[model samples]
Target: MWDRIEPLMPADPVRGRRWADHRRTLGAIAWKYRTNSPWRDLPEELGSFQTAHKRLIRWAVDGTWEKIFAAVLAAADALDDIDWTVSVDSTVVRAHQHAAGALKRGPKAEASRLTTHSDAPAVG
Candidate 1:
């Protein structure tokens, strides 16, 4: 996977400072997402959390992520690994009654309802 992604990485233009190792940075990113942990809590051995986070953001902003995803999907399709047919079961699906243009409560009514509580206040 790393081999596949390495070629898709954007080249650093006018390189002043060398970028962090891609493998370690990618590992940090994967770990963060896999554990649903904060970037600041990323493991030290995987390199700086900021670097991983920055790389993710940069790739997303520059459309590199989308390109990589498309490339991967294309590769999978070429290898005949993708099942193009999609199946939908209508019996298991549901639609809310409100979908039929039901009237929605106004902001004032909603606000009052949220602020109004039945529980009595606690006494010291």
Candidate 2:
């Protein structure tokens, strides 16, 4: 898979410090999402989590990922390996009571806060 993607990555900038190995950085990124863990939790062999995070964001903004996706799809289509089938699933999960905007301590508590003091003595 790296063979297919490596070529799609952008060339390292000429002025800045050279980038970390693209393959290693990509592995770190994949590990992060696959485990649904924060970037700070990335394993050591994957290199610095910060580098992985930054690379992911940089690639996204420069459209490297989109280019990789398009190239992979074209390759698969050439091999007649793509099914091109689409599936949509609708699933619903109910929200918690508080998430539904339920009132705290019912309407009576809210009404008291809304009432004004009549005997405060109006300013002239």
Model 1, 55-97: lDDT tens digits are 9898889998898898889889889999778898778656686
- Per-residue CA lDDT of model 2 for 21-112, tens digit only, reads 99999889889999999889999999999999999999999999999999999899899999867888888989998899675696785775
Top candidate (TM-score): 2
Please identify model 2 stretches exceeding 4 Å from their true place: 84-87, 93-124
- Among all windows of ten consecutive residues in candidate 1, which has the lowest summed lDDT? 109-118
Model 1: per-residue Cα lDDT at residue 99: 85
True-vs-predicted CA distance for residue 121, candidate 2, Å: 46
Best by lDDT: 2
**Per-model CA lDDT versus the true structure:** 0.81, 0.88
Model 2 poorest ten-residue lDDT run: 115-124
lDDT, model 1: 0.81
